[model samples]
Target: MGDFVKKLKTLKTEVEAEVPNHPSIEMGDVICEHFAISKPEEKTVNNPTRASNKENITEKERNKRRKSEKEKALGVKKKQKKPCGFCGEKTNLHTKTTCPKNPNARRMPKPKVS
Candidate 1:
């Protein structure tokens, strides 16, 4: 019985000595929790060539997209006309009347022959 008591005491002392006085949370534990919550490894489903004909888009759809882009580039949404640099009057590229470089340009008179 005395031997048993001594062994029990020794075991208790050993366990106590190994126990931490004030155990702090480890950074690895927090990192594991963050990974579990965020789940950054989830797969995405975007196609690499979806924006172009490589994705099997119909011809009509492609034409429509092209037209939409052209209209946007030409500022078709706004009706206000841009002024010509020379004329100071609103004119589009298709029907510009006066050259912007010389608003008051006049043809020079031809030199009289001697």
Candidate 2:
């Protein structure tokens, strides 16, 4: 136990020395930069085509583009979702060993086996 603690303390000191100034960045500065409060001039999108060219587009074309953009923003594409594996159900939910209905969930051994 003493050796374990000594080793842990040594490792802590070494890690601290290796990672000095990790938090040199101020959180306020980062938030301001990210939320565009401090530097509004940094917005590179000077002329967004969607809003700028809205007057030129026809009603049908505008509706189609708006529908596609809404679908993309909501991740409603046909390819992203697949069937669930647990019950072989056609669902968009995720499938993994942790799924409750998965038969294979109970087959994996617990940590106690080690």
Candidate 3:
């Protein structure tokens, strides 16, 4: 009878430790309420690759990633574009009228030579 009483006391203590003092509210709910945070919304199933592929990324990010990948897989990344120099637009941040060099420009005196 004494051994049974000792076992019951230990079991009662274990139950008290596991259970919250409050009967109506749970521990996690209490924390969320104190912080004023709503319960997290459930997320739907997602396609793995669609998210990464559709992100709006700048050219610098693309180029940096490409260079690192190239260096890892192959040898060194041979050539890299300077800022705004990828498509031969080195002199960026200018309007078309004030451009220093124009490939399709004609001579000043249009018909003098002929």
- Clash totals, every prediction: 1, 0, 0
10 residues in a row with least lDDT, candidate 3: 105-114
| C-alpha lDDT of candidate 2 relative to the true structure | 0.60
Error of 3 at 14 (Å): 16
lDDT of 1 by residue, 1-114 (tens): 999999999999999899867767688768878787543476777667545534456767766544445565566535566776555656443223344455454533223222
Clash total of candidate 2 = 0
Top-lDDT structure, candidate number: 2
Per-prediction TM-score, please? 0.21, 0.28, 0.22
Q: In model 2, what is the error at residue 110, expressed in angstroms?
A: 89
Tens-digit lDDT string for candidate 2 (38-107): 7555676667545543346676775565444556545643545556566565544445554457766744
For each candidate, the alpha-carbon lDDT, in order, equals 0.58, 0.60, 0.54
Q: Against the hidden true structure, what lDDT does model 3 obtain?
A: 0.54
Top of the candidates by TM-score: 2
Model 1 error, position 44 (Å): 26
- Cα lDDT over the full model 1: 0.58
Candidate 1, TM-score vs. the true structure? 0.21
> Which stretches of candidate 2 lie above 4 Å from their native place?
23-27, 39-114
The full ranking of all candidates by lDDT, starting with the best, is 2, 1, 3
